[model samples]
Target: MKLKTLASALIVSGIMSQTVAAAELEISVQNLTHGNQFTPILIAAHDGDSHLFQAGEMATPALQKMAEGGDIADLAAAVTGAGGVTSENPAGGLLFPGAHVDSIMLDTLTMTHLSVTAMLLPTNDAFVGLDAWEIPTEAGTYTLNLNAYDAGTEANDEIINGGGAAGTPGIPAAPGMDGGANGTGVMDGSSNDKVHIHPGVLGDTDPNGGASDLDSRIHRWLNPVARITVVVK
Candidate 1:
């Protein structure tokens, strides 16, 4: 009788351990830019079938708000409503270039995928995004490189006029304060009306009057603007 009781206890304990282990996940994000700053970032783990944003599709109102103004409240609420786990503004504020931010251990057993987004400062409607990455079941760390995406909700005016609201035509502010002033906008027309890879800022050398309000040499960047790592334990 004693032996049978011990075997049953061991089986129950093993089942509980597996349940606990499957619920927890760890995720980390890094701002890999050389000169740009990332505004408040939003990290979420949702159902594998759901996505925060998709390429070649119109930006959701929440995504547009976050991309244009660096606000993540709405996006957080949206993800929560869909039964997802979320960590909002993990950096508290701007994640400076080359800075790293880690999310608190997230128990996303039911949530099978992850998504992240943050606006890139000193540009109009440009954001770094990770959409619906499948979290592996094995215990290991996975790294991914992210690209800069244009929200396509506003023009790339590049004017730092403190206009961050949706539908505004100018950049909110240059967090680094490295942007120029008093110049014409970059492009009056955008070919893509949906979310797409950013064409990068078209900055000029002049600060007083030029085609762009950013310095060409200082603001330019190639693809893969951000990096993210997920550790499944």
Candidate 2:
């Protein structure tokens, strides 16, 4: 029994040691949307067993807050608690269209996986995500174009209200100020209760009265709304 206990302790020590090792990584994200804004981005490097958000799965409480509002506090704390390295809001504030933050350098020695998440403004619960992407060990720069995702935490009401908290009914704010007002709302409920690819938004030209507050011509985007470049140094 004593020998078995000793072996277990040694195994745990090995794991803890590996987790403290670091990998040098320079990371950045660019917003490709024409007019949309990305809330503070969260970039993390963790083990394969952890994930910030996963498609086809229900979002966690932390993720729900982020997707519904531009809140990264909870998610960042969660990642740090999970034995991972994280960079929050590298751009200092909203990452505007065509804008990028390239100064993030992560020494993710023990962490082998990478993920990024940030809420897209001018809509409810819409976010861009990269879930548990494996960080390549090879010394090269990797570029990935990411798609928008819905946290499935709120209905895409397309209304801009001051409700940014979790379980709120509307979008908190739209920095672009291009969205309309007096929107009746777009949907009564979310069709899917799991994180999934955003169906894109439906907006009308009317600003005074419309089904959605977002401007279709300005807010809509194709796949790959954000570009991520990771350099393994």
Candidate 3:
């Protein structure tokens, strides 16, 4: 009878521990750029072993597809397949500059880290990224500043052509429609083949014919293009 009682107590303890391990999080992402818009954002609560994109490393094909085309399907599938929780396109569509998407709820059962990603329009293979941030066990509000990363898969030609496919040589659709036209490409090749910090866009003054389609004064942005707030509950 004592053994039976001890076994039952152990089972109850295990269940209670499992419940304590789970966490609910309220996530909010804000676009801090002046002109650039973010494509559908992908937020993932995953284990420490998983990462959306790593600096100084070659980008995965899934990451390349997202950084180039603003497509998060592949990345979402990967996160879900790894037993992770994902919130895809929380903003419902393109997140314009100075806009914020709030109250995104994610139930992280066993995941220990968080990651975020989204393509920045009007640039070539540049995307906002947050890689493998440790989720604190203590409940509190945490803020993070995200930066723009160059996938290094394509050159920053600064063209406004609709070339979103991987290995393409131009920028995809510009949501603001503020981009110029009839501009020559910025560069023929990329200087780095691995993922790294973006050098930012190089726009010209001429709208009709210049070295780039982007406007240097309007489209250019410094680091920390996005801000993420996580509320641990």
- Looking at candidate 3, the ten consecutive residues that score lowest on lDDT are 15-24
Pick the winner on lDDT between candidates 2 and 3: 3
Q: Indicate the TM-score of model 2.
A: 0.91
Q: TM-scores of all models?
A: 0.89, 0.91, 0.91
lDDT of each: 0.86, 0.90, 0.93
Give one digit per residue, the lDDT tens place, for model 3 in 24-137: 999999999999999999999998899999999999999999999999999999999999999999999999999999999999888989999999998889999999999988
- Which ranges of candidate 1 are over 4 A from the true structure? 1-21
Off by over 4 Å in 2: 1-21
Task: Tell me which of candidates 1 and 2 scores higher on lDDT.
Answer: 2
lDDT (Cα, 0-100) at 26 in candidate 3:
98
- Residue lDDT tens for model 1, 1-233: 99999999999999876753455767778888878999998889898688889999999999999889988889999999999989888888999998998865788857878889999998888999999987777788888999999998888888988988888878898888888899877775777989999988888999888988888887878889998888777
State residue 173's C-alpha deviation in candidate 2, in Å: 1.1
Decreasing lDDT order of the candidates:
3, 2, 1
Candidate of highest lDDT: 3
